[model samples]
Target: MKSLNLYIFLLLATLLGTSCENDGDRVVLSGFQEAELKATATNVVLSNENSGKLVFSLMWDAGQLQNTYSERYGISATALTTTLQFSTQNTFSEVKEVVETSSSKSYTGKALNSLALSLGLETGKAATIFIRLKSSIAANTQSLFSNVIELTVTPYEEIAFLYMPGDLSGGWDKYTTKVCSRAGNGEYEGFVEAAQWNNFKFTTEMSSTSGITYGSSPTDLYALDDSKDQWNIWFEEGGYFLIKANTNAMKWSKTAITGFYVTGEFNGWNPTVNAMTYDSAKKLWTVTCNITTTLYGIQILANGDWAMAYGDDNKNGELTLGGANIVINEPGTYTITMDLSNPEKYTYTIK
Candidate 1:
């Protein structure tokens, strides 16, 4: 029994010594080593090959790290984040960082264009782009940067307008020409008024006779055969209409508005109190009401609500939202006519 107890005590002492040694000894984890990154191409050129769109691709090799630190630190080398640092100068003074999260080394040129615009680079001008790559290893360590590459990109000119030069309102003049705004997907829209025997056509320029001109056909759209062959779209009777044209599908549509109203201080600012009647033959909203002598403003309200309301911006017949009130200094019977069919030339007459 004495020998057995002595053996048990020795075993306990050995175990305690082993535990103390382990407590004093620190287990160090290996960290990531510097990686050498190389790009497949040193320079890239971006062009508007695909309908004013350019795509950029970068192929690279990330060097091996020492000690398998990724596995030790619960990280994957493949999962490391990659980012592109872009700048106009080689010194990288105004650097913009764009992350490339995809496994593939591809980026769209549109992104580079946006960056260029942000950097004050003008469109249609060639600009040098300096770019470098950053690869992250661990959270605590610094990221590795690849060699810089220079790229030359020429952004395309963005065109966004279609003009209507017609004799509907008057002769083909700048004041009578209607400007149509682009609505994306090769579509343009605007409002125009037409009278019987009036002729008008779509043109790229307001005053010039050059460039593309659209004319009416039995089909959706057609090019004018010659300068004299301006096939104008006409209306049997004079009326106001909204016009929408799709250049891609070669189609057009028109919508006629039936009514609108004047509701404001003259009518207690109540939309439903008094309404204006539309004269289909005249293509105008006409109303004559008694107004108070007190200072009051009027607004044109459509469908008796604030959702669609127009006020005079300069009180000079031109209508726009958030405009100055149309005030009547003296109370009397007044005649008001609103012509809203032509968005480019909206007017309200007071008498």
Candidate 2:
């Protein structure tokens, strides 16, 4: 009996010493819990609705993990049939190094399932994380912790120009409005066009869910042409256009174009061409082109001065600069009139 008791005491001491040696030199810490993670939405688009860029950050009892990984924590987002999985590597030690070392793995990509991070006994190993919403996971539901995250994206621009006439009938009577991504993932009901490029002679109307109506510019889609070969083949459903090139330089008007003196003289014709007019109700621009040649083409110009002000003669509302800016020294009701006498002219009020 004395010998048996002595043996048991020696065994216990040996086991305790072994455990201390293994755990003393090395300490492992779990990365972070879902509640500590944060995600934010940067941007989104309607045409490309389901996909967007998201940025997330992690914070936890980093302790030794930060120094173990050679690279900044690596992040990778893996896609499953219907979801995304985030995977992480805790700490990777170099095989050659005697001193403890660590390597890190991160998550990136279009996150669509479950995400797992290596932790606990899995230290210095890879971990596949299961991402589940707090509402779905009973472990996370009652706990005051967040296991999964979601956020809605906002767009860079609230409103964008989608349509300008690309191909038109000889009379300029029928046209298609070009399409682009809308702001806030909203719908674009309708658009207007100018008689010609560079001339701001078009009208536009748009309304939000609030039932408030707003005027827009006759955006120019002149740059879209086969000559440059930048855009895809003209697609009606996709809102693309094929444009012409090398047309006579003419002065554009709200309803007409003129001053083709050089081309007119070369072709033994008059210098002035008829103005082009866009019938909003008809959604068409009609013009008479007497001097004929295939050299005529349209270039898409940038939207300038169109989005700023509107016909806010009374400064009671936000002044969108459809016309010019006014210097109002005194505050009161000011009558600003646009030059309607000539459809080709621009007019507005300052006060």
Candidate 3:
């Protein structure tokens, strides 16, 4: 009877030990839980003088590092690494990473202007900057993004001229064939004559052997090849054209002009009286007439109508609607030339 009692007591003790072991295992596993991460920032500003020295601060939850690693990998957060990433795109397509190792809840860093420039953000323009925290444990990683911040950067201007080189244009000369003007928006615009089936492209410098050249593509502009297979854009018929391009956007467009005329003080302000001749090679309109040394108004009429007329506001070069009429101080067999290819700075010379 005593042997039976001892056997039963041993069985009960074994069961209790197993239950205790299970309870301890549960406690260990439940200690780790998913971590929550967040970040905050103040205003951000960028400028030319301060671009290289730009700095910003970010504050985050203190226990995120520990909780994230513990919950995800059953490891201590001290073994994980952290980085601050700056991106122009909220999707984080392109990112610049800066290592951060602050045990405190906040971090500060500089070199923001350099990062902004690398992302192609123009100076003197405001852009939305996206920032985030990248945490990693071994090869496993995760990102926590902060609220987007808007900043304006003062960009340095790089003087560049666009040249047209082709078989029919500029005689393929790189140095003397510069025809495009760079606008404030970084676009290039000018006039060029393309012969039927003639090929041409734009270049950054006056060199056929060196410098950046933009070539034609079916969908968008492409960088030309250095050695061979350089593509040239051609037109169906030979004519004078107005070309505009935004190289950064890889976009280009062209317009063909047929004729131009002038009518105002020279012809009693009649739009149909005097017609100017178009010099296709020079891409200008020219006319010669006798006039008095009177302060008479003159206007450039296109296709002989009031539908389109251009006048100068300051009488310097810029053209605007309802602009002041041109004044001819001296009257002779004056030769007048009008260049309308550049409408923003349309000019006329009287000699």
Candidate 4:
């Protein structure tokens, strides 16, 4: 009995010593539970009727490194972030991610439908989307990924656009409104065919009275005036022209390009021959020609004359006035395109 008691005492001492082995100033990752993402509904059909209503709400825990290990050892952790990922493809071939500091995110019917459509889902068709959460500390170490959740959603059709109507059609006819497209830099560009007058203005919608109208200010035709009483911008000459509004610089320019034609070996270097057709919608000139020579020269001239000529000097798909002849390799049929949208830079595409 004495020997057995002595043995038990030694065993208890050994266990106690082993427990205090890691009780020093060392910090280690003992264990952690990844952030789990949840949603209010796994299946929903977004509708226009319920456009204002909430479709679903996503909830996830804020990532913070405050585990028992941090408490055991005095150590401060940097800011942690949680990002939510959304993808229509099951394999997540393309993903749209949103970083959220809030614990919950809610989407309305219209918002969800727009998101679904933007993610390549068809309208009125049910498709599944994958969503998950990724959490990591400032160190970007020990990244924790949550389980992916699938949501089947049916979306509605919705399109947002701005159409400009002006007096280039002789009157304020919404039917003849010249559709203007805004670039990413807030500049508006469009084509207008004027017959005998150049009085024009931009409208925010198809109908002028229903939406906002932008017109000339007291400064000049280029300046914009934001008011109910707006003046129409006008000029003397009337022709097919391009109107560019630079809101950033508070200026505008009107350029007229009558026509473009190909003058090259294909047409015996005749500027008036092989008239290229102008694509009004795309604002480009395109032409197809047959080349009998493997190496030849081609030039794009204006007004069926050599008043303004462009050529590819370095064969780098760029145009320079009176540049070198463009070399053609391998005789075959090809389509050529001229892009003079930017007055400063001119480019061409041959395929």
Candidate 5:
């Protein structure tokens, strides 16, 4: 009985010893022997034309730790987290965690372009970035790092947009659905007319299969959360509203609006005089204006205010938020069409 007890005690001690500093079986990463990082591409250029294509991939050797030979990759395989960081300087003065808890990290042209621009990298210009991997059981200890990799990538200019579709957006399949254009940095704004103010949510894309979907938080009504399935944003009643979304702040607001108006040099900038007519079938705002005189610069105003306004910045028919006023060259009663239907592209037409 004594020998049997002694054997069990020795077995436990051997197991405990094996759980710590190891000869090979359960080696606790000391954060000294660094991991090896491999990159698929070290140099490339990013453009909206190739935004969907994979730009590059960075992978690291996780050694036996990834194999999960034992529980507790420090504490356990589940506790080990790998983070991929981005930095412009080798010193990593400013670092951003691009990926987490992954052995490999990949970026597409769009993803990399957005990240580079968010990091203050100039568009269409070559810029160098450094990437490093960090594997740690916790924030303060047992961390393993990989050698840094350098990349030279050039990103392009692409204005981000958000899509809002619901009962108000012309049955959800029509091209006439109103779009919330990029108003400012991380901000979006649009004018929507809801007959019943039913269900609606924000999407990064028009489709349902992929892209991000943002909706009202389950806990807070005004706050927004990023989820594929979440609470649909609601309104108290059905009416015209100026919808605003700030992705950076993760909040959305719907301001009740009366209607849209055509305010320009022709009306002496009087927003209230020329009320634009809403065509329910076409889901657009239209007005037949008699420009007996030369009308230079016309702007579409929401709720008779500049809070949400659209004009042709380049005078090329396409509308822009707070853009330069649109000019009318021909003099006569002409139909001005304001189309806010397609997302990512808004335009106006003068007939």
Candidate 6:
């Protein structure tokens, strides 16, 4: 019995020795090694999620023994839907799952810290959004942790136009002359100077039958073959005719305005044939005319120079030397002193 007891004691000693030997060589990491763990989650939804929720964790001892959790990414309890948990001895890390939704119609499961939200973007630059976070788990499990999450936002922009320069009131002018000839500057031309109003309203109607009549102005030296050959109509809708003075002369050309008849009758009687445009740069109002020689079927005893003989006021009387063959070459107002001594100056516009 003593030998059997000795053998059993030997067996027990051997077992204890073997166990100690195995344990001495084994390496176990509790809080001994550096506590560093990283956690990552896929499919993250930031909507309604706490911005500081755990997404990663790391732990490092500062002296005393304690468990702590920290992250390198922005964490939000709401940002993580799926979850993963890991630990570095004293540190805890987690990877979470999340779901993105298009609910609320206008609300998307994405960060909206950008300029696009502020200005209501149309079609320009793209806004930017980013999230960054830093967290430190407390040394004491019960102590409060230090965590931070940041968002950066930016807006987009582009170039655009507001308004253009032009007179809105002067829409367009369309005029037709007798014999189906066309007249007037319907479109703005670089060569022709624009007409200016002295005291007339731009919105007035110049189509009144009693206001003004159309006949050849003195500037138009050419005479029409027939009264029916000189009529001209102007289409200045929404605006009235305005005459501006040039720097050339002191007299403005005037049109012989007669009584108004219906449009058909007006068209039937070509009362005038001259249209003049002032060139501000050159200080001249150029006249355009078509003069035919078949008046009264007589090659009348008058100078071929259309202006001189017209001083015959009665149209039937013969020309007298007292009449001045007034030729205007500059920009200004002109008055025909046919009855010179009378000093009756007829006002005419050139510009």
Weakest 10 consecutive residues of candidate 6 by summed lDDT: 180-189
Best by lDDT: 5
Position 121, candidate 4: lDDT: 77
Clashes of 3: 1
Where does candidate 1 have its weakest 10-residue lDDT segment?
Answer: 220-229
Show model 6 residue runs off by greater than 4 Å.
1-269, 272-274, 280-285, 296-351
The candidate, 1 or 2, that scores higher on lDDT is 1
Pairs that collide in candidate 4 are none
Model 1, 276-341: lDDT tens per residue?
Answer: 887755767788888874376787776665765778878688877456777666888899887755
Which regions in candidate 1 have their CA more than 4 angstroms from the true location? 1-177, 180-190, 193-201, 206-209, 212-239, 243-256, 277-284, 339-343
Model 1 C-alpha RMSD vs. true structure (Å) is 20.8
Candidate 3 regions exceeding 4 Å error are 1-87, 92-153, 157-160, 168-175, 208-211, 219-230, 265-272, 279-284, 290-296, 303-308, 317-323, 329-334, 339-346
**Higher TM-score: candidate 1 or 6?**
1
lDDT of 5 at 299: 81
TM-score versus the correct structure, for each prediction:
0.37, 0.19, 0.49, 0.40, 0.63, 0.13
Q: What lDDT score is found at residue 231 in candidate 3?
A: 65
Q: Is candidate 3 or candidate 4 better by lDDT?
A: 4
Residue 42 lDDT (model 4) = 92
How many pairs collide in each candidate, listed in order?
Answer: 1, 44, 1, 0, 2, 33
Q: How well does candidate 1 match the true structure in TM-score terms?
A: 0.37
Best by TM-score: 5
* Tens digits of per-residue lDDT for model 4, 1-351: 323443443354455446756774323333234777889999999776877788888998655544334444322332455777788776777776666657787877755765565466777889998998877553425667788889999977644222444565546665354433222233556545565555767654456544335677766767765443357777667766666765334456777767778877767888777778877668688998887664567788867668568788888998876888777887778898987655335689989
How well is each residue in 283-303 modelled by candidate 3, as lDDT tens digits?
Answer: 777888676544666777655
Candidate structures ordered by TM-score, highest first: 5, 3, 4, 1, 2, 6
Kindly give the stretch of ten consecutive residues in candidate 2 with the minimal lDDT sum. 94-103
Better candidate number, 4 or 5, judged by lDDT:
5
Question: Local error of candidate 1 at 263, Å?
Answer: 0.5
> Which model, 1 or 6, shows the larger lDDT?
1
